[model samples]
Structure formats: structure tokens, C-alpha cells
Target: MLEKLPLGRPEIVVENGKQTTVAHSLKLKSAHIDDRLLPLLPTAMDAEQMRQRLAEHFREHLPNFEFKLSECHIRQVYYHPEKQCGVNYRLVFDNGNGTVFHEWLYGLMIPQGSATGRFERAAKRVKTSRVVQPFLQDFPPVSQLDDLQMILWLFPHDPKMKRMPDAVDPDFMKSQINEHAALLLDLPEAEARNWHCD
Candidate 1:
């Protein structure tokens, strides 16, 4: 099946007035082309889009919980060639009775020559680590000793497909949601309070 895919053009490099054609071949693992798993894959999205999607996902799975999204600003953390960028944004969940859980979410930006892409990526990377670190004392807890935890980082679109890789499984997503929901629901009020933002 992989062999049926079209090949890309050879890369040509010119150095010192000499042109060289370098052959390139497509190398794909079996999982990459698995037809059975393609429908379950996630599409690539930017940071803000990811945040909204995640909030929706959580709401769909755990309808009883209240989820809120906010931007976390960090000052002078990331210095891009074009502009300064912060690191991350945040998602806060509450039971509407003062028990809240905070998760710092950020997207890993693909390094690019474009100034806009460069700045956006740099901002999210820095915001998650720099700003969240001081307030929580440990932005990402070293141990999973509690229910409250930071969500996973988001990734940008694949340059080729313009979306995420096909490896993301719906079952895996469901499991993650279930695990986190269970942990959050089981957390004691005192412990949950500790996870609240200010």
C-alpha cells in the first residue's frame, strides 16, 4: 500500500556552480498507512483552536463540570527575532462550589522562517514553563500523586498533510478523558483547592 503512493521530486543542491540531484524515497511504517485507524486520527490545529476543542471535549465527556479557558501572560520570557512571545495559556475547571482544577496548556510551534509563526510558537512555549512555574512552584508536578494535573501539550499541523499524524486513537482519547475525569471527581475538596488558580 505504501508503494502505491506517489514519490516526491528529488532534491537538487548547487554548490560552487556544481548541481547535484539527491534521490529521496518515501519511508513509512505500517502504522502510518493503516486504513483501520485513519478515521480515529486527530486533525492538526493551532493553540487557540486546540484549547477550544479540548474544552468542548471535556464538556462532552464530563458534562457536570464547568470548564473555562483563559490566556496566561508571561513578561519578557521568549525573545523571537521579530517579536517577544509568551509561553502558554490555561484551562480551569470547577464544580461551581469553589473546587477548581487548573491545567496549563500550550502548543509546540513548528520553527519556521515566517515571523508570525515564529512569534506565536515562541509565546506558547514560554508561557507554559515560565509563568506557571512560579505560581504552582512546580508547573508540571514531578509525581502523579494527585488527581489534579496539567494536560498534554498540543502539536502543530504536519507540513505535508496539513494535519496531525494518523496515530492518534479515539480509544486513547476516551481513556485519557476517563482517567482524568475520575481523578478530578475523586479528589478531596482540600486537595482540589490546592489546584485552584489564585
Candidate 2:
């Protein structure tokens, strides 16, 4: 079972002319993973299955909000000679009325070098950040839509992150948009091929 961690609030800070959003006062109590599941850890379930599990977990704990799973993938991070592989999940949850929304990223690590594969740890904490609103206006009126539709509507209109002063990384931004479009919107392969971000 996943434990609930209380994260106080969200704040925005400007540093070196860049805007960053951060959450404070969030702490997760210790969580243990079942040792029997180590070997088949991340790959045991497909992305959709993982997303469903995440949604259920959050719904159980956060009954006041609606949850949407935005992204899920197996990720490996290198630390010098050692590497750690885990499942990374990005989720967006909103107040039932859609007046407020928060994004949370979670990481679950898998144990390595063990004969019986097992999950090493549950997510230590979920750092929640507010979704960036477009400069011209607030998020569209998406309250009436279902969870998936609300996410798709808000995602495309999300303000692109600025890499530096008055500039954006077009390739990186396009890839992000394209990936979400393909995955969430289920765009046809040919249509996705022709999609362009500008």
C-alpha cells in the first residue's frame, strides 16, 4: 500500500532569469516493496497497466481529486560506475471542480544483482508542481470533460518551457508535444509523422 505524504503548497521562483516551480514540506514515510516481485519489477506490467495501478492508488488516497496518468516509462540513471533502473510516472490530479491542478512525479526503484528480482523501494515522495499556464490566459475551461480529455486539452496548450532568455528548444519541445499527442491522443502513425510543433 502507498502511504500519503502531505505536501504543503506550490511556489514559483525566478532565478537567473528562469522561472521554476517547486513544492515544499512534502515528506513520505518509509515504504517497503515486496521482495517476491524484484526480478520482474518494471517490465512486469505494460505502461497502460502501470498507469491504471497508479490512478487507482491515487484515487484511493486522494478521493477529493481526479487523477490522470500523463507519462510512464522505465528509466535508468547512472551514478559513476553504478546504475539504477526504475519506473518513472508522471500524474496530474485536479480538484473535483477543475479549478486547481497539480502534477506529481513518482519513481519506484528496482533491486539489482539479486537472484530473485524484487522491488527495492516504493516512491519516497511525490513532489507536486502546478501546471504552467499559458501567458495569454489561464487553462481552458476543461472541467466538463472526462479525465483523459481534460488532460489532452490542457497538455497541448501548455506553455513551452524556455531553455534560456527569450528562447525555446524547438526540437526538445516538439518531441515532448509529439510524444504526448501520440500516446494520449492515439494519433494515427501517419498523422503523427506529419505533425509539427511551432
Candidate 3:
């Protein structure tokens, strides 16, 4: 069914060499998510154990590249040892990539909650925000996760897409999904435009 429909949503494809906005570039400065850091932090805050759950990604996966958050400025931090759900370790910087990751991971648990926490910028695109992290060992296919992976599967390594739960689409969603893949694959802006605007 998706193959028959034409893509109408035009995307704003910014090239790799292309310069990003001050806010965008600044955000890049504090981007990066080091999976290695996962084990470094406390097990509870590091990650949760569940059959299926959503997770927000970061621009860099680790903004500082080292994932050294020994003193990450905590804003509206959340943590629940009993429920194993909370935003206990999040970095919210008002300067440049403020709420860069906090908001991102927060978006991951939004559908289940009231979408609390800060970085209130009208959540980006859900297509890249919602993800199903099945632990490398579990390795759940991007398809099995379904709605959970609706947002994250498209852009697995984008912080901007982390809190973008409002980005996914059911209306010609495939086109949007394909458009996302094109953008990630380093397709030129002109070429990507053709894909999304088709």
C-alpha cells in the first residue's frame, strides 16, 4: 500500500558539510550517546529491564563524547527504584543544547505518562523519538517493536529526533520513513527533496 502512494511531505535536508544553526551546532557540541556509558552509570538509572519499551536518543549519544556526566546539571530529574522509571540522570543546559538529552529520554516515556519534564519545545518528530531498545542481546527487529519503534527506528543516532514524537506519521508514513532513511544515508539535499516531495 505504501508503494502506491506518492510522498508529499517535503523535508529540510541539511547536508553534513552544511553548517547548522547556532542552536543546532551548539546542540551538536553536547551531542553523542556512548552505549559504553550505560554500564558506567548506576544500573537503575543506566537502563531499565522490560519486554518492550521506548527510549530517546541523543544527537551525539554523548554530547561531550565521553559520556562523563559525573556532574551533569540536573533539572527536573526523575527516578523510581520501585517502578524503575524516572528521569534521574538528564542534562538540561539553558545555554546551547539545553535539555538536549533529558527531554529526549523523557519523550520516550511520554505516551505512558503525561509527557512531563522540561525542554518543552513541542517535541520534534515521533518518527525518530520513539524507539524500542531490546538490549543488544535481545535484538528485537525494528519491525517487531511496531509503535514503540515508530519514531526511533528511522533515525537511531539523532538527538534532535529523540524528542520528536510528533514527527511520525500514519498518513503516507512510508514516504516519511523513506525520506528519513534518505536523509540519514547522506543523500544530497536536492536528491532527498525529490524523495520527500515526490
Candidate 4:
């Protein structure tokens, strides 16, 4: 299931399926290909462990790739009526922008043509879009989203390293993400055509 981005419950998983959307909004339900799936995050013991897992996972998953998590700052503890206790990890990274890993999984999901062209089209469709077209490429996996307040790659809850895999399903992931999106945006579906996955 798509847990809240970054700091939400790490139980959401993304597997192969068709377009999955929340009932009210168009947030990405789990997308599928060949009944296979992309992965999702799982719980971490703590911030330190989470950091270790994600750092290594990226290196192993990408070739000739090196990303560092710097500016390791933290937000003051805050509580969400919904999130219970939510904390923000402030960090910067070197992004191949999932360019290598994306091709390895799904041929570059970013749309073709001028990135501006794609963004313009996508922005027109997504009502929640505040600025110009936010093409999946314009934002990429690294660009920050005003709504998500995240770069998307910061949380790698699931690992290729884990012995026992823990995955959340499409339906569950969609529900969680949709719920979170609505809570965050007060809009139904703000998902763009292309996914800015990490």
C-alpha cells in the first residue's frame, strides 16, 4: 500500500497492476506491468537503521551510482492527528534521478518531447498543479514537491537486501496514498501522468 510519502507508515507496497486511483482523486494507484510490480517501503527499526538500509540499497540497485545523504537535519517533533508522530529528515542528495534504475525496471517512464511540453500538458490536467507543467521529468524523482514536501527518494523502506521481503499490495498502497493525498491536498487525485519514483 502507498503509505504517506517519506514519513508515513512504511507498510505500503507497489506491485504490478493497472492504474489504481483513490475513489475521489487520481493519485497513482499501484501501476502494473505484466502482473509484476515495483517495490514499496517497509518499516525501519529507527532513523539510523533506515538511513543505512536506504544508502546501501541505492548503491546496489544502480550501477556506477553514488548518492550521499548530507545535511542530516531533523525537525522538531510534531504530532499529526492522523500521523501520530511525524518527523522530517532534512537531507540533500546526488541524483542520477533514477535514470539508471528506472530503465532497469521500466523503460524511462518520463514522457518525450520537450520536458516543458510534457509538463505543460500534465499541468493542465492536474488541477492541484500550482506552477507550470510538472512533468514527471521536470520534477523527476529528485525535485521537491510543494505538497509532498519531499524528494521521494528519501525513504527507502523496502530493501533488496532483506532476507524476508515485506510488501504492501496495490489496493492497500493506493488506499493509503490516496488517503494521504487527500489529507494533504484536500483534492481527490493530483497524480501526474508519469510517476516520479525513486
lDDT of each: 0.33, 0.33, 0.28, 0.30
Local error of candidate 2 at 65, Å? 2.5
Task: Give the distance in Å from residue 47's predicted Cα in candidate 2 to where it truly belongs.
Answer: 1.2
Clashes of 2: 4
lDDT of 1 at 42: 17
lDDT of 2 by residue, 67-119 (tens): 35444432211111112222223344444455534432323333344312221
lDDT per residue (tens digit) for residues 66-85 in model 1: 44543221111111212211
Model 1: how far residue 78 lies from native, Å: 3.0
For each candidate, what TM-score against the reference? 0.24, 0.28, 0.20, 0.23
Stretches of candidate 1 exceeding 4 Å from the true structure: 1-54, 57-86, 111-198
TM-score of 3: 0.20
RMSD of 3: 19.0
lDDT of 3 at 21: 20
Q: Return the clash pairs for model 2, or none.
A: 38-117, 38-118, 39-117, 39-118
Name the lDDT value of residue 28 in candidate 4: 22
